[model samples]
Target: MRPTRRRATVQHTPAQQMLGAAEAMLRHALASGIVVPEAVVETVELACTHRRAGGEGELEPPTPALLRRLARAHAELVRLVAPATPRTILLLSHGRRSRLAMLGPVRLVRQMLVAVLVLLAAFVALSTTDYVNGTGGDILNSTGLSLLVNELFFLAAGGLGAAFSALFTAYRYIAEGTYDPKFESSYWLRFILGLMAGLLLPALVPLGADAEAEGISRPLLALLGGFSASVLYRILERLVGAVESLVRADSRELRAARRAADLAQASDRARLERLELVGHLRRLEQQARAGGTPDQLAEDLGRMVGTLLPVAPQDADDASDEHPQPLISPPAR
Candidate 1:
């Protein structure tokens, strides 16, 4: 069996319903953290053309002042309802979705630098044995399988160098006294790029050993490699931070754009409602001047009120009217 529920109804005048609509919008704004002027509220509350107003102050016609206040309130309301903005902490985490989505100018340059550092680290590792054997360690002399033996040493050194470079960077980062990893922008991509850059290390080794590098000893070359890798690591950190800032800026702009649209829409809607209410008030004035009875004035205003200012959606379940709901009705007319 289907059960049909009966809806309740509340009696209200045309002016009262219009005021209710304005009040509902004001409450919505307040809930959304907007601060509307008290004057607007006063105008809506004091206007008593539709009320008995036994001893209450008589409300004057809609003045330029009242309209302006309503206009400002409506503008503020929509602007307040936009989505909340992102925090700085959200932007910096290398895990930010925006960063993962694409690389920017700073990020690209930073990644390239990281690649170079990784290659240098690999080079330093692969050439360590050769440097030692050449400098009188003659460690390869007795191995008979000198090339094979040295190749293993090269592999060991490269692996260790790569490991140490990454470790050193992490250690330095931790030592910098920042306990919040939320602000960290480091990623696996930088390390992987560094690995790709490692191939260039062999060619770099000769440059270090050449006549132009006269004062550069093996230890000095190792120091240069370690120092350069660390420097590149710092540069990448800074560059990624800039990327986070860029992302945050973009996020802020997006929110602002949404708010601007809302503001314009709300303002336009509020303006339309005001214009309709004004027309209704003007008609009521004409009826009163024509010496219409209170009941007739109310009936006439009632027929038009449904169209001028519809009730709030939240009020739907609480009340219903016998007259057709204008906004809900088809525009067949």
Candidate 2:
């Protein structure tokens, strides 16, 4: 008779499986040259030792404490290696939060559709009502309510315009694969700006001037203003520039006139000084013709020199040292 044969089955416990997975991750990190710390590697190796200590068929399950340590080691290893991993895989492994980010583009498109539908429904409701024609007696009974309703109509049109722009923008971003949740806030801010543009454009500008003649209505103009808020902003900027230019032109003319007046004053002052100098010269000539003495002539000439070139206090001593020299050689008299 042939010898009997023995069959052995192998089973891996949870702790062993976890330890194996950690070791596998560590090996991959080392192979990829990810620079994991030695402490982390030692911790992972120590956890792996427990599985190897029990030889084949021994089935020595790890205690809860050992399992926890093993789990921590595995977590650390994954953390070290995650940065080198691709984003798509990281998103998948990280659970719902990351997956939700992946859905941002879709969510934005849905929101755009919903907003458009809401605006359409509001427009339909307004069109079917007598408020559109201003013929509903009870609805228009209160003047305040009438004004409020008109404002609401303009807001709705503005909202519709904003919705249209947001839909197109979201679609463009989605196609480019660069969509992000941060862009949602920008879309909302644009909507608010559009609403303000719609309400303020007609009031600040004369949009209703040719409404009756050109067959255009106030709400239609508001819609256009909201749709092209940038255009309205450009127009307002140009108006401000024109007003500033006008003010500056007036200021420039005033400055020119002031400068001319200053020049005239300076000219008059110079003429008066020249007249005074001429009078002094005439007196000196009269003295000379009257046969004035050398001493008197020297005194008059020194006085004239002192008046024309006044010396500073510090230079007065220097001027005195040179006083012995005759100023004009006694005029050769």
Candidate 3:
């Protein structure tokens, strides 16, 4: 046997070590639906990959290039994962004696599981066929019978709708956030109105008459499916909010019902800052086109130091397959 060669183990520098740790942490956040932007991943990757290119055993401190990437990654992390007050959800359930209940993390998991099951049911209804097979043949062609098959599908649709309705009624208690009997009765009445609307909306959809198949019609079958789906989604909004809050470990949407204005103000400030920078660049381009001297251009630019802060500020925001270089400074003269 040929001698087995042991490949030399690559020793990562401190920069690489830190980058690897950061990438792992960011991945965990992403898996939990925290929305870690792609640029953050790219910055971490570039920091490690570029530093590794410098060769093994080079224990030098992180270069400015690595530092800048780290700074970008830090900014992204701060934006996404900054600590906030955890919001509480009111979860009112019923026993013989009714009282207030709170939605702890475990109850949140149960809600998410139901949401997943609802998605599964919706997928099955969309994918499976009981009435018609390919080439317009009867579903049970051997005996030349498709009547029972048609009924079976209609029954399935009814079952799906009933299942959705039960889930809807059960979730209404949690959705309302209170166990007041009078309020519950009022809400139930209003819910019946919307449920009727969902059922009727499907029939109102204009599926052209001539196009449907001869037996039981595709449009009618489709209408049943849409009705069930609509009912499913009615309960789904609450389910989604619960799942998102559970994933984020914060019920910002549930507690406040509106996001913190600081986020919006920051966004508006960023937008205005972006517009100002673009205007500054346009003026500089006009100066360059007019053949202004470097001295005049420099003076004009010097006057707008605060305005000409940066362009495409969130370039690394989506660090994906395309590895964008982190902006370290203004463009070279």
Error of 1 at 89 (Å): 14
The collision pairs in model 1 are: 119-197, 119-198
Error of 1 at 319 (Å): 99
Consecutive 10-residue window with the lowest summed lDDT within model 3 = 84-93
Q: Model 2, 1-333: lDDT tens per residue? A: 998988765576766666666776677678768898787787777765766787765757777877777788878876876643322222223323444454332656566677777877876776665555432212224356565566666677877887778777866754443455556788878878888877666555553345557766657766877777886798789999999888776777889999999999999988998898888888889999999998998898888768778557977777888776767756555
lDDT of each: 0.49, 0.68, 0.52
C-alpha lDDT of residue 109 in model 3: 27
The candidate that wins on lDDT is 2
- What 10-residue stretch in candidate 1 is worst by lDDT? 84-93
* Candidate 3 C-alpha error for residue 151, in Å: 2.3
* lDDT for position 95 in model 1: 28
How many backbone clashes can be found in candidate 3? 6
lDDT string, candidate 1, 179-256, tens digits? 234423443433443433332232244432363347644334333433344443555578789998877767778899
Sort by lDDT, top down from the best: 2, 3, 1
List the candidate numbers ranked by TM-score, top first.
Answer: 2, 1, 3
> What lDDT score goes with residue 277 in model 2?
82
Better of 2 and 3 by lDDT: 2
